[model samples]
Target: MANYYIVGLSTIIGLTILSLLYDSFDMDMYNCGSTLRNLVVTAPHDTTREFSSKNVTFDIAGKQWKDVIVLVHIQKTGGSNFGRHLKANLMLEKPCVCQRGSKVCNCSRLGSEKEQWLFSEHSVGWACGLHADWTEMINCVPSMLDKFENARQKRRYFYVTMLREPFARFLSEWQHVKRGATWFSSLHMCDGHVPTKKELPLCYKDASWAGVSLDEFLSCPFNLATNRQTRMLADLTKVGCYSSLSDAETKVKMLESAKENLRRFAFFGLTENQVDTQLLFEDTFKLKFMEDFIQRNDTNAASIKQEDLTVEQIQRIYDVNAEDFLLYDYARDLFKERVSAMRARRKRRIPS
Candidate 1:
């Protein structure tokens, strides 16, 4: 009787130890999986090759509700129109509530009015600074959200943006500047410090670069508008911010970094490809827009005739925006590939 009792006690103890070990192993695997996912999603990759869509997966609706969508609004990328669409056009279970004469809308989560799901100028009002770049957004957005919520919680951030053809975007920016539009309020925060006057001088002495000629616009070596898209999308810190702006090697690194970072973004749209942009956005987030996106060719930049410029002047424009031209080409190709993959996936989902 005593031997039988001892055997039973030993068996129970052995089973309890095995269960605890199994639970610990399971938890470890879960933590490991989370870490791996983060690494795959966020880590910088080779800029030479295109990334496969198979590895890029997201919990669309769940993330849209639970996580934050950060928009890196590059100027003259048709981002303003897209922002408006996000605020008013999206068909959602909990639509963003906007107030009259307000620049911002309440893009709160499903149940929480205070906790926001979308972080952009339209939703959060330049919370990271006026037209914050990728470097500034990545650094400021997470902490800003924590401050807004008055709590610290780990939340995934999905960054999105829109890209435009380099020449058109540059022309649009010039037109905007010509109309007295100045992004002078932009902090240009990088590496925990704004670029000093010596590091980044103003293109004009006046309050705004109004009525500036295209030649004058191109003449300013410090003109942020020259390669605006590349600079905005790149991690400036990698190229030593504005300090190494003139270095050829630095420009190369910045362009490469920008390409890699753009690839890492959750989604990006092309201003020229409105239909594809809308379809991709809808498929990406599992959310629909109330109306189809309309392609507007009659933009400020479109008004500028290429035939009006000399061959030399055209070459100069392309030379100045060389980095942006490369970046845009890369982005457009990637965007098309993703759109094709999305269409293929949709076809597969339909019943035979």
Candidate 2:
């Protein structure tokens, strides 16, 4: 009887694994274009209110939060400038092992599970504002964290993130990399051939796209080009690298997770709306972002105008990042909804 029971249990486990694998690969067959409408329902746009006061009270995520903000800094999205401004003016700066040690520390990737956990936890505990990747958020303060039973237990933990249109971000990142931007050296390194068993994130491994022309870059692989924003938003444990997203089940799971995370964020902004983002963030947090701050304005040098890219290149970028475009569309809609709600509240407060 015991032998039969064990066999039954094993069979059930095997079936479950098989089901998951099947779901992961099944995504390849579906047409994303047909499903995009279902994915991103358009929201009514709202006019933003101009802020004049510093002491205004605001509520976000259906709750009032005055302190604590976690900024998920997506790469090449003007997140650095935002994070720096936040720390220099409003919030306590967090210590990144990479920042403290070198321009790029392989500690997170090279270290053991325990080491990574310690780094992540310490970074979170030490900062009034965290500007790390989404992976750190998942590792240190998972729902399973012993110190907190739920997100409410850490009521101060407010999440925020900024996103760019995928194609624009990709182009900017590519140009930046081509210029051999020192900060992006590690990421650039991974554009080459990736070993299947490498411990680093898959983005840090694939070399097929490195040192290639625009056409060649597209042909080599689409790992980094595809759904990076979504991957960053999803829990890292489930979404390791872009390669993992190729599995239909994993892709679905990751997309669902990203959507859920987006819902949880108190403030989601777009790079295209930098001024509005700054104002909204300040008004929401009751903290000022740099308006008079002198930043290195290398806009013309860094930017590759959309018109410069040929139709074929543009299409390739769009085709590779279909999932990201979908997520981005959803994020834009969500941002509009949140902004509209805020605008409505402010309008109601004003007396005629």
Candidate 3:
């Protein structure tokens, strides 16, 4: 975030004009007292724990997982790179719904259409992997484990996901949509925040953020800018779409559940630590990704420099993604612990 900046040179009246132009800005409408403050909320009581204490690492001695891996692909979190690696190293079965000559792959079915195809009728007897729909498959273990044929295969169902710093991800997503990324065109086609007609899809209607500036967009009630990682990790059925207004107990339970689920994952990686992430994959799955493989997508969307965002935008982003920040911290600690444990185990291999 050191490189990130906000262009915070606007006057109070300037902000007013920007808000009026966007039609949804209300940062000035808040009823705070004279002395403005930025309060940092502490993580939940249960947010901290010894990562090494969790028994989440899988035993791959027989490499039963060599054929089956499930990835929960979080957008803009180096998913393209990860998918590229998978395509290059592993023999993927083409999706059932996606025809052989189709130029566009529709993954709109519960956001796991690709994963659905992986387990669909057409994908049997293939050594491949699936990009899971996190929302539809929040109970990561059982949802993926059930896909395996038997107990032996179930033991090999590897689940992995990568997380990013929330603000960076949100900024990337905004820029991606702003630039009209081909993949996100479904939701990015609309020209404004609200659709003029009644027929637009919910995503497009809600995310028609075209005319709004970054600060203006951040000020609005943007769903994707919220604790997205937490939402994806959360068992939404159990907790039911948490918000700042949700009861305290409910949010705590959701956070606790998400952390527990992360522990249950075969491997949890970070976009900031892509090398380590790939190393974990190679070490766990026993496959080498080629050095020359194009892992990242080419994008002209410039990153939002931290200094370029207003104080309000920065605070808004932080406040909105508070849950994700905590989750990312926990995941970082877990990743380090798991990597250290792997190295220690390697040192004690006792060559036969």
Question: What's the true lDDT of residue 306 in model 3?
Answer: 59
lDDT of prediction 1: 0.77
The positional error of residue 104 in candidate 3, measured at the CA in angstroms, is 9.4
Clashes of each: 0, 10, 13
Q: Of the candidates shown, which would achieve the greatest TM-score relative to the real structure? A: 1
Q: Candidate 3's residue-wise lDDT over 151-241, tens digit each? A: 3232234556778866678777777655544232322111122222333222344445465466655654534545667756755555544
For residue 96, model 2's alpha carbon misses the true position, in angstroms, by 16
- Show model 3 residue runs off by greater than 4 Å: 2-67, 90-135, 138-156, 180-207, 241-249, 292-302, 350-352
Candidate 2 regions exceeding 4 Å error are 1-67, 91-132, 141-155, 181-212, 239-243, 290-302
Candidate 1 residue-wise lDDT, 167-187, digit = tens: 788888999999999999999
Predicted candidate 3, C-alpha RMSD: 13.7
Q: What is the C-alpha RMSD of each candidate to the true structure, in Å?
A: 18.2, 15.3, 13.7
TM-score on alpha carbons, each prediction: 0.84, 0.58, 0.59
Candidate 2's TM-score? 0.58
Which candidate has the top score in lDDT? 1
Error of 2 at 203 (Å): 7.9
Candidate 3, residue 60: lDDT: 27
Cα lDDT tens digits, model 2, 1-352, are 1122232344334433544554433232112233322222221111111122223233322133212355677767777666555544433122224356433321211222112112122233322123334555544443333343223333234467889877667776666545544232222111233224334343334433355456655653434545678777876565554345566566666765676567655566787777667666765665555353443335532456656767667666766555566577678887776677567767988998
